[model samples]
Each structure stands twice: as C-alpha cells, then as structure tokens.
Target: MKTAARKTRPAFLDAKRGVGNWAEATEWLRDRGIEDIECITPDLSGVPRGKMMPSSKFTSNTSLALPSAVFRQTISGEYPEETGDFRYDPLDGDLKLVPDLSTLSAVPWESDPTAQVICDIHNTKGEPVVYTPRNVLKRVMQLYTDNGWRPVVAPEIEFYLVAQHEDPDYPLKPPRGRSGRTITGGQSYSIAGVNEFDELVDDIYDFSEKQGLEIDTLIHEEGPAQLEINLRHGDPVELADQVFMFKRTLREAALKHGIYATFMAKPMQDAAGSAMHIHQSVVDARTGKNVFSNPDGTPSEAFFHFIGGMQQLIPKALVMMAPYVNSYRRLAPGMACPVNNAWGYDNRTTAFRIPNSDSAARRVENRLPSSDANPYLALAASLGCGWLGMTNKIAPGEPSYKTVNEGTTIDLPRGLLEAVSLLESEPDFARIFGQEFIHTYAGVKRGEFETFMRVISPWEREFLLLNV
Candidate 1:
C-alpha cells in the first residue's frame, strides 16, 4: 500500500476555522438576511434538540435552557425509569445552551431566511454537562490534547432515499428520480444512476455550499437509491458537527423533493445497510506532522499501536458504534459489512483497513459505526480506542492477508443488549468516556431494547399465527 508523497496539510483543514467569533456570526446572518435561528444540540441518539427563535432573540438570549433529561432520552424519545446506579436529578434540572459560533449556518431550505447553530450544554453552575454526547467527545479530545496529539477524521456516510410514507409498518421503497421511475437495481458507482437524480444532487451540493460543508466525493452504493458522501478530513469535533448538521440538511432537502432521506442502518429487508465509515489519523500537536509516519517515510510504531488499541477496545465500545436494535442488522455476516474487527491492507472485508496512501496521508479506516450512530460519540469511541493503544503500546494482531468474509468467525456482539452489557462492564471505556455517561447511556439503550422486544413484528405473526 505504498504511494507517492503528497502535502501533509490540506487547504480544507485550514478552511475549517471559518465563521468563528460573535461578530462573524452576526455578519453571516446579516449578509444572508436571516430572521429565524435554530439553537440546537445533539442528544444521545444524535437527534437535534433545542429551541427555535427569532435571530434577534437568539443573539440577545445567551441564557437558553433545555432539560438535562434530554441526554437520558432513547432513540424512540422515551426515558428510562431506572438508570442503572445513576439517579437523575429529581427536578429534571435545567442546562444552559452556549452557541459554538463556528457552527452557525444558513437553513437553505427555509422559505424565510433562517440560521442554525450548534450549542454546548452547561449546568447552571457553568460546568459542562458530562453526559451529553458533544461533551463526551470533548472529554476524549482533551485526553489526546494531554498527550500532545490531535486526531483528524473524515467520515464517509451512506444512506437511502426512500419514497415518502406515513405508516410505520409499511416497507420502504426507493424514491423516483427525475426520470419518473423508481430505482430497481443496485447501481454501485454508476455515473448514469447518479444522474437519474441530478436535480436532487444539485440541491444537495447547493445546500452544502450554503452551509460551508465540503463533500470530497459522491457515489451510488449497492442499494437502490443508496448514496455515499465522503467528507474532507479535518478536526474530529468539526467533522462530527458537520455530520450532525448534514443529516438534518439532507432530510430537509429530501422532503422538499417529496422523498425521505433515511440514515437507518438497515432500512429495507434485502438491501445492503447504511454505514458511517470513519478514516482517522493522529497528528503531533506541537509539530504539524502525522504521528503515524516517521521521518524515513515509513509506518511508525504509533500506527501499529493505534490499530492495536482499536482492535483491543472497539468490541467493548460496540454500543456507541451500533446504537440500536436495527443497527445490529447492519453488522451481520454479509453485504460487505465486517462481522469482526479484522485488519488488513486495502481489504474492505476487514473492519480496520489501512488504505493505500503515502506516508503523510497514512490512516486507518474504521468501518464499524452505522449511519444511525451519534457522530460525536462514534468518533470519540473510535479515537479513544486508538488513544489507549498509543499510550499503552498495545500490539495489534497480524493483518489477515486472506479475505475475511461471512465464513470467518464473528468477533462482535450480536445484539443491542449484548453490546450494552459489554460497554457497561468495561472499566477502560468508563475511564475514557465518563462513568456517569456510560451508566446513563446503558440505561437508555437498555430501555429502548426492551421497548423493541415488546413489539410483534410482521415476520413473527406471519410465521407463528397457526404454524407454531
């Protein structure tokens, strides 16, 4: 996996620092003639939760508050009665939302000019709410900072564009393209297939530019109407914020065309599932050099250790990667998904892959996280695993030269509850992601799994009504 030397720092990484400060944000809104503002934050499930108000009120009101219980909510929007050993504030305490000015962007789909800004959660005492997903990422980043390392990440998200439907029980189908016909076959990397929705693709590009997001590439995936977008590599936090906002922006853009853009891990029964594959590398904070490569232009000890860390700890952190009952469906034996945490060079079959690149751009691509995962938590968990490897000098197993497919043994948790229990019991994960956060997350996911269990699926009714 050797390649020619290239520039270590790219322009997009430098451009990520745009739109910082209060004056800049105000000017951005004024320039766009923005009237409304959506002050938002990502909950445990990566869903946006916060208040919407007039732009003027948003700038004036720095005291915006949301209930602390927002972090305790499951993907289904239900709260758990018992949160393991962690007790919620009896009063359901209020938390302040402080805007991250860099995230301020225009809501391009709004008929009326509107803006959206991501916020950080803080308690009345002015301390960060540790259990919040954003803060949890920051906690992990701070660990890297302590070690004089800065992690950079690029996320490749895959999702499906399905026909608009209201019924929960109805099966999802591919949305019709500009040709006025539904996509009926897998069209991986087909230029003609991508052109079928040229108008929608144009809107996606237009909306992304308005929001200052950079898309590295776009390709048609193996599923009908399933597309993949690769984001330029940059700071982990900034990339996570972009992914969070991009999901909403994509859905809004899809709705405008009378279709639904779904980030579900497994939307259809037979189609390939969606994934959020993350490519990551760590840089020396003091020196602007990739820590994974040495001066001799070869892989460094840090590179192997990082992979070792991921291999050692990612299984314990599977709950963060595959966060739901449906998420597990995406992690099964086939359809190009990894059933185990095997590593290899240029092998898609392995969960961790060292892509063919020059020393300066050397990185590991973690293909574990589902599209439905909280980007903040997913990046944090992935990076946290690598951090442990580097610090502990953990050695990774030999890379599998042979194809590791469905016939290969599975090394990951098979279900949501199984994944949750592994995360809850791992002390190393609790040390990286806060203890209380782990407890709260486990409780919320456990509750969601229970809720899913009570439901009677169509498959069960069809098979067991008279036969069993």
Candidate 2:
C-alpha cells in the first residue's frame, strides 16, 4: 500500500532544468530547499562513485577530489597488478570532480531534500580523465561533432522484479503480485502483468518525472516478472545520464515496494535474458538532417557504412557492450538475443536491425548490448563504430532474411575473457576509445573473470561432486 503522493511539478524541473550555469543550479537548489548535493561520476562498472556534501559547500568553484584508482578498480573491488598500459599512478593521485550543472536534479526518493549532479573527471593538469565511463562517452561524441555529425540514441532497457533475498547462492524468484501470487511464465506485453505492480510502477513514473527523465513506454517483457523501459532519443551523453539515473530510480522504487529489481543480463535460468537495445542515427549537426537518407529519400551510403562499421567492430567492442561475466549468458544462441553481428531490415534476430520508417526517421537498432552494460560505454562504443564506418565508407554485407540460430557461425565473443582479449588486441578500438582505457578496462574485466573462476557453481557441485 505504499503509493506515491500526488504532487505538482517542481519549478526547477523544467526542460531547461540543468542547462544553466552554477548560479542557476544554486537558485534551483535553494528553491527546493536542498540540504545536500550528491557529486557523482560513473566508474568503469557504471556504479556511481563520489562524495556527498552539504549544499552550503557546493558551488561552481567547489574543488572536490577522488582517487584516480577508482577507474582501475574491478567490479569485485579488487585491483589488477600493474602491467603494460594498465598501471595507475603510484601516488594514487586525485582527480578533480567538475560538476556538469546540466545533470543537476533532485534525488526524489530521498526523505531529506537532496540533489545529485554528474561530474566530469579531470586530472591535476585539468585534462579529462579519459578512462572514466562518462568521459569516454564525451570523447566519442567529440569525434562526431568534429565531423559536423551529431549522433542520437534511444535505449530500451529490460529488467526483472524478484523477491528480496540476501543469499546469492539461491536462485531468484519472481516477486508476488497484487493477487498475492508469484508471477510466472512469459508475460510479454501483458497489461495485467504490468498492472500487478501498478503501485510500484507509479512510483517509478513519479521518480523519473521529478528527476527530469522521460520514459517513452513501459511494457512487460517475455520473461517472468520482466519489464522493459524505453527512453526518448536525443544526445548520446544526455540519454546516457538518463539511463544511469533511471536504473537508480527503478531500484530505489522497487526497494520501497519490498522487492528487488535486477538488471542482470540473465538473472535466472529458463527465462529470457535482459538486454539494452540502442536505436541510433546520425544527423548533419548544422541542419539537423538525418544523414542516413539522401534527398531522394533512399538509403544513403552513410547508412550502409554505419551498419558495416557495427558489423566489423562490434565483435571487438563486445567488452564494452557486455561488461560482466554473467553478461555472456544473455548472448547465447537461441536466447532471443543476437549471436552474430549480422545486419538486416526489421530482422529481430540480427545484431543490427534497420527499422522501417520514413527517410527523416531512419536509424539502426543495435541489439547486442546487455542490460548490465554501462550506458555510457555502450553508447560510446556503438556510436564510435558507426562514426568510423561513415568516415571510412565501409560497405556492409547483404542483409539476412532468416534467423541466426544455433547452426549459424557466431560472430561474437562467447565469454568475458575472450571479449577482453578481443578488445585489447583491436588497435582500431584502442585508437578510438584510447589505449589507456582499453588497457584498464581489459585488466579489470580479466580480474573479474579470474574472481569468478575461483567460485564453485551449483552445476559443478550438483553433477561433478561424485561423478567427476
């Protein structure tokens, strides 16, 4: 019975809410009676890492520092040994947090009046910390801007609602619904399934509105207790910020409703896996014209090149798109996920699907990334590959008309370590995403895989304990 209270939109929550300078941010905070500010940045794992301080001390000129080592830390909280391009500063130096006032918004779930702003990481010399996930995204966007092209993206993220459990050893179960029955079976687009958790869904909407995030649609996915949220398309950086914030908002809202929401690529066996499908298109920066279509309204060469780039580079860029060990679970053949980097028009099984639309709305939907991916890194890699394609005029292969099933040769990395190796060995990605970041990301992922290998799984114990 935890329903959100109806409230009027806050004045600070305008369309231009976060576009103003620090003075405007201060005014907004003051009007909302914000007591604290959460200065956050997305680390390699997409986890929010930063300090929270009293609003009185936050300003445009406020100097805050976090260790550069944060970017090198693995998801397991362990650091890999210094090797090759993976070494961090011996002093573990500080990186300054320069708040992007455009990302400032209220933390609506908080009882205390609080605000959160995403920050840009900078070294002591004021150069961008290129490995930070958010900064990595900005670096890619800069490439598009330099070429007079502006990339736009819309992400559809899927997740599941599960009963709260503390033990990771136990398999997750779908949470009980309003009828007090556990959710079961496929509920794709089921209105009743979505309405089962109507109160929680309301909170999610309320929270997103307060944070200036927009939800295009919410629908029940094919998996039990699974749901997907689509975000409106716009600038890659802003959409990344919204996705990052949306995850937090949904999780918080779920907790309040006495359940857990998970974005794991494959949180359960026998159920469909989760994915974050990105719909992308580039436009002439000056004219806001869709570059994928010509004046004749036919598919432009740039469109094919973008698909070619995705087909050629996504295999190497898999580490960024599917970052975790469990992420590979969602990419297996026959899982309703793409196993190859095939391109096709309106083909759900291919990695790149060009949806049917008018010339002005032409775009490619990248169906490879898992829900566990860092939104910033995912968008950066996806857009970076497309940028390379158009610039180099790479030609795409013939589109597929059939499903890429088990018999098809998989064009993607099958595991996390393989993905990391593929990424590290690809010089093109090193040039695009930076050698330093590639090294650090590979190192961290390698460490995570090693940590996972140390664990004994249920399958091993169930079958191998006596048989082996």
lDDT of each: 0.90, 0.90
lDDT of 1 by residue, 1-468 (tens): 898889674333333224767766666666667799999999999999999988877766468999888888878888888854756779998999999887877788889998888999999998998989999999999999999999999999999999998999989999888888999656999998899888889999999998889889999999999999999999999999999988997998888888999999999989999999999999999997999999998999999999999998999998998999999888888767998888999999999999999999999999999999999999999999999999999999999888887674688999998998999877888789999889898889888988999899999999999998
Candidate 2 lDDT, tens digit per residue, 15-74? Answer: 433847767677777777889999999999999999999998996477999998898898
What's the distance in Å from true for residue 106, model 1?
0.8
Q: Find the candidate with the highest lDDT and give its number.
A: 2
- What is residue 163's positional error in candidate 2, in angstroms? 0.5
True-vs-predicted CA distance for residue 145, candidate 2, Å: 1.0
Error of 1 at 255 (Å): 0.7
Q: What TM-scores do the predictions have?
A: 0.95, 0.96
Per-prediction RMSD in angstroms?
A: 7.1, 5.3
Off by over 4 Å in 1: 1-18
Query: How many residue pairs clash in each candidate at the backbone level?
Result: 0, 0
lDDT of 1 at 271: 91
TM for candidate 1 is: 0.95
Highest TM-score against the true fold, candidate: 2
